[model samples]
Target: MSTFEFKKNIHLIKILNLKATNINELIEGLKKIPLNSVYYHTHRFLKQHQSISPEPPNDFAYWIEKALNMKKLSEIVASVNIVEFNKLWELKNKYIEVIKKNTIPYERKKKCNKNEEFVFMGCKTFIIPTGDTASNLPEFYEKLKIIESSSIYFHIFESRLRIDSQINDFQLWLNENSYSAVAEEIGKIDPYNMTVENLRRKILNIIEKHL
Candidate 1:
């Protein structure tokens, strides 16, 4: 196994709030943040789609590396054949090991900016500063403009249902974490009837008020 490789679980996205300055610290931070999706909808997606996934191991590598810019680690995972694994845990262990080995020291890269706008599932949110200030209101609303123009709220969920369940799992995760209120607001939207723009507005509205 390469030293730069570690076992990966998309569930890590649920822990994105953990502060880390480097890959090594991020791994440690993840260890402390309990996983919210280990036995959640992930199982359903795997059981229904593994045999049909379009090169799942490679696809998995692509997204993880894209999120973190960890090329070597993705390369290692990209080489595996999912068909050979008898169980998900086996593959999961392989990913975990990749993270374990990926500890070479480097400048800490914050995976997300609390102040910078976060666009996920085509909805927008930001790191709401603790206190209100006249200066922040304008900048915060500007983030809303970006979301109003573009949002992917339902697209990822509907699309990834074929290959991955993380999209749905992430929504469930938000409900359980700090975004519980926002998640509740999202839950009330009727995906069957709403347009992408409508869902985007609902999510952004929640985030705008809270967030």
Candidate 2:
């Protein structure tokens, strides 16, 4: 059996030099921006406000509603359940579809003021080992408690997008190790609905219950 080596990621955010003052430009930027930019904008809120409620609308939804004053369209875009998306492109497409499907052709070109332009941004992600390794369930549970919240975020949120898999690192490792029942419990957790600290506690409780 192989040990699960824990890892964490650091992101260096950069301006994509893309800005949108209207719905049409926003859609064009969405289609033209790098996948990393899409990922950053979508998940930026989650990563930055780990202690806050996870219901904060994503950057696009926030800007669209606030700047463009497209409350209904913004709500529709925000309502796209990001948890269901395993890939960045999938998430991007959903946003594009929601916007296009909801708006009339003339409405698509409606513009916001110059001050309220939506600026596109991206990040360079660097993954590194945390020097934490677990060979079995007991060790896994113990490490889960002490690891940084970012590590929890990485394993649960970022890993799926990175690997282009529907399941997360913890669940994948657990299932591979014949802990399918435990993995199933983990799969039921909605990481988007709670603080990362809460997520960590929930995961620990799940693992402890089975121990």
Candidate 3:
């Protein structure tokens, strides 16, 4: 049988030339920005706050609330379920749809200060092997407890975007190995709602039980 070679990623943040001071410009930028930029904004919190998961607000929603002071609109945008969409474009469209639908006639005219403009940022990911391979469920569970939280985040969240698949790397691997029940339980996890450390614990518990 083939072994699962664990991998980890490091993301370098790049500030794009795009910035938006008003709702109209923000929508335009959203429509045209690269999918990597979209992934960065939506998943930035998850990547940065591996130990602390908050109410789950993307950069767009945060700027709308803090900079523009659109409390209601920001709330609606923040509520975009990051886990629901597998494709980056689908997530981007949902954000544009929500923001466009919520903005009033005069809301488009609202603008923040020059310094408060929403600056678009994207990340360049470098995936490297961790040299940890698991030949079976027991080995997988043992390695899971010792790997970095970022590795957990990569396999669970970033892998979805990388493969454009609904299932994460762990789930996919498990299912491929005929561990369908374990994969299903892992799929039940909501990656956005908990810290990466907590997510690690949850996955360990599921695999440990099956072992």
lDDT comparing candidate 3 with the true structure: 0.89
lDDT of 1: 0.40
lDDT string, candidate 1, 1-211, tens digits: 1111111123223323444434455445444433222222123233223244433333334444655666776677565543344344455555556656653545234353343222111112222222211123334334434532212432223332323443343245454455566556655554423344555567667668864
lDDT digits (tens) for residues 29-140 of candidate 2: 9999998898888887777676545445689999988888889988888789888998899889888989989999898888888788999999899999999999999999
Which pairs of residues collide in candidate 2? none
Q: For model 3, which pairs clash?
A: none
Clashing residue pairs in all predictions, respectively, total 19, 0, 0
Estimated TM-score per prediction? 0.29, 0.94, 0.95
- Top model by lDDT, which number? 3
Instruction: Determine which window of 10 residues in candidate 2 has minimal summed lDDT.
Output: 48-57
Best by TM-score: 3
RMSD, each candidate, Å? 18.2, 1.7, 1.5
Q: Better model by TM-score, 1 or 2?
A: 2
lDDT of 1 at 109: 44
What value does the lDDT take at residue 34 in candidate 1? 34
The regions of model 1 sitting more than 4 angstroms off are 1-60, 107-211
